[model samples]
Target chain A: MPKGVPERGSIPDDGLTTRQRRQQPVLAIHTGTGKGKSTAAFGMAMRAWNQGFDIGVFQFVKSAKWRVGEETALRALGDAHLASGIGGPVEWHKMGEGWSWIRKHGDDADHAEAAREGWAEIARRLASERHRFYLLDEFTYPLKWGWIEVSEVVEALRARPGNQHVVITGRDAPPELIAAADLVTEMTKIKHPMDAGRKGQRGIEW
Target chain B: MPKGVPERGSIPDDGLTTRQRRQQPVLAIHTGTGKGKSTAAFGMAMRAWNQGFDIGVFQFVKSAKWRVGEETALRALGDAHLASGIGGPVEWHKMGEGWSWIRKHGDDADHAEAAREGWAEIARRLASERHRFYLLDEFTYPLKWGWIEVSEVVEALRARPGNQHVVITGRDAPPELIAAADLVTEMTKIKHPMDAGRKGQRGIEW
Candidate 1:
């Protein structure tokens, strides 16, 4: 046998490799017209927190009253915060009225500005290893529409602290991001409640 | 067999059965004489948060200066508040004066009362479904010691608003409480620095 020969079913023993501690945590988000993208991001956050990593989350589209599991669960995570819409959907109908929930319809520049500010907040948090995860909810749509600069986001990821994990989500992700991510998932829409003529189910889909 | 009967090995109809939704959310904390209990609790918190649910948590047993992931992560959560150490441990501890670490030398009643107050705060959150998850850190040991009333706890669980989850943790969980719980996990101790002649690892165990 050679010095580094391997058996058919088993390789020669090289002793158990010591676990390399994780470095440069993670920066990922799901984008595309699909469902469950946010769910996927939050799942990762949960896993990271279990390992004693800090986490932060921001939701662009949801209102304070539209409470869901992750938002509620995060309240217990001593340092986590979520700034979101206040009451109703922040969509095309509710353009900016100076309320956080307003969508600022058709105003690409305005939307882009808001997104930029959100990213800036995220960047500040990401600079600290004290908080390891930052989630930007519904971030890609603004980025895709030229409301936010994709290059700025790339820079943010590059500059993130060694132990930080960042996640962003929205429809229509830039191709450059897809090529650069450690993990990427696409939540394709097979069917949805609105399609079935049903409002969002409280405590379930919302 | 009757004609048109479903054949064996054929797939059963895959549809959700119409059962009453689990109105009482399950609360679980992975705590014991070992570490990682807080980390596990934080994981559940993150899971609940991503779903956009409202939640409340009270940190008992640990000091304000003894900041960790929960303290750091929840800072962004906005709604979260930390009322730090009540000057006790899950079990008896011996600490030198002027420090807040767990002490076997502290008065039992002081510890018990502090834990009771914590439970009351959790119960207050449970009264409204606005916060879907309520966490009481290091709660069970005090309960087991008769610091908090079992009847009151049972009543609180029964009175909890719909879909609210409550999590409590500590060493030596009572058998009666375990039997009543929707989910209970015992974190068995396998190894520890205390046994290995090393202090708890910073950021890993503490």
Candidate 2:
């Protein structure tokens, strides 16, 4: 192994050294009509945080049902890093607020503008390499709802600066984004307790 | 809704009250060949931890190449909980030690015995409600290899005590476990950068 980089047993002749291959950016997405898509992306963020990578979590959802616990834990982790200088900094940004599954009140026009602004800010960050790991949680919804262009988002990710890794999580991801991704995983639902009248518990759901 | 529990719009008339339904335990599995199975389970563990649930992570594997970072972050979270009285306690146990992907060691018989013992221990804990959230990481291997009985594991999970939520992660899960699970998500791979000669990166992979 050159410079302690695992050769991965086989490598295509892409004219890039193993080190270069190791340093390449990762563009991935978690998509499907199932749960754990965003959870897995958050899980990757935890690993990235452990490795001292600057983390940026952008939530682009039409509604917020049960993600409070996740935010609290990640924020605590971020504070721990800031206090002890163990891990890198973490920044969490929500594109839209007050959109609820049970009670919806936010105006669509305002949310659309906010979503556009969020996408623009993410695009700027990608260009400047602001964060090593960018987690765009529930991002496909805006694209699905026609509030953001999937092509533009893909182009920005494809041209991201440095070794930044981007992971997007949502359902019904556009084919263009899927085709452009280096890795994509669809969380297919086989069964759910909600089908059996089991209500969401506070700890498990959030 | 009754007592602020979300009714979920549709609930089958299973004779259980909304409160009882809210108290029902969840049995879930994250399976398939794609990535994010373990990551999603870890993500759920973080959520469970945030909600003040005692977490127990049991790792059953034939090889351990990475995963050092995950253990570190979770342990730090555990320590913070004890120090600050926030979140919950965490117990992480690895069944097999010195088993490596690069250099495989340890006798098969020993590992099988250890896995059996580990399963037995989990069964005991589930019966006793030792932990509020049980994470059986990569536990399908032992069941797949017949070192542990899938049916017995399913029975234990189905008959688990209290409000414990159990999530198992691995590839090629047994059909019995799948049938017994309330939630199952198969991570289907759409694309991978490794196919294009991309080696694993430290901050992302670990």
Candidate 3:
């Protein structure tokens, strides 16, 4: 009704009241060839964390060795939550080499297996309502690379019970997942610092 | 050279080495019709805060009446930083009606003046290196509304000294601003809950 607000019913008929809609879980996907997909998801994670949502972070591509700043801050918040009982649980898992199973048997097949295992774990968590908010960082690659099937992932996500929110971030997300998601954002690159021969810097990239 | 990696020299010859590039200030613009532009900037601010960078957040469009989750978390971090000397200073300012000055003198001309004043304060901070990281949230709106001049903002940003990092977020960013920025990302909307008649939700929109 407002000048800037989108026209009424421009938001398609989802056949739910505002209250009913608020109760429904959200599946948000951030995909594009820009820099902030994961970062934006992490920001949402921060908001969810502050609201006392149990948060799970599953990193698919970032090396465990790479110390991301948001991870550290959020992990600290998690620790504080545990100590003070102010917030909910926070769990961070790296599906790359850092995963114990993959670490035990390192190889290409193991990497693919590890991705499957990671998906399985997430599905388990989703079924059990393990976390209210899940950040699947750089997850689209698994689907794109065929390490994980998009259809299966979509099925699991759709079947996820309760009000669990999931955010998947990466470039070139599979179309099925995009179709399945309730919210999808594509971070298109207009220009990049690397275009000027600049590398990622601390506190900016991480 | 690699499949995913940009080709050698694809990053233009800025004549800046890794160290030099790292030391150079960053002007990042996040603009698009999609969500997460401000959220991504806040994520970077969190990273900057964790890295002991003095952080300043200037809100241009968001109502001061609305309390954002990032502001709360960051202000808390700022307090901890002050008490424990672990991180750096964090200052949050609202240049909207919530501002005492603007509230005291409410008018269209005053609103325009307030925008100018906000820019002037930022310019002053830039000159003095008041903060290492600045999040100019919803900043592009003022420029778009002609409350602030594009050339002036670009000039101020370009003339900024030191390694101070600034992230400006808003939709429909002026072409001049994009040209001046070293990094720019347009958050294109693929799908949104609002498209399905859902309003902003807690821990997601805020």
Fnat for every candidate: 0.08, 0.62, 0.54
> Model 2 — interface RMS deviation?
4.7
DockQ (C-alpha based) per candidate is: 0.06, 0.45, 0.49
DockQ of 1: 0.06
Across all models, the iRMS values in order are 15.0, 4.7, 3.4
Tens-place lDDT per residue, model 1, A19-66, is 222233445546545444565465445444535555556666424343
Candidate 1 interface RMSD to the true structure: 15.0
lDDT of the candidates, in the order given? 0.49, 0.81, 0.80
The prediction achieving the highest lDDT against the true structure is 2
TM per candidate: 0.42, 0.90, 0.90
Q: How does residue A187 of candidate 2 score in lDDT?
A: 90
User: Across residues A41-85, which tens digit of lDDT does each residue of candidate 2 receive?
Assistant: 888888988988999988886545566677777877888898888
Better of 1 and 3 by TM-score: 3
Residue pairs with colliding backbones in model 3 are none
Query: Which segments of model 2 are wrong by more than 4 Å?
Result: A1-10, A98-109, B1-10, B98-109
Per-chain TM-score (chain B), model 1: 0.67
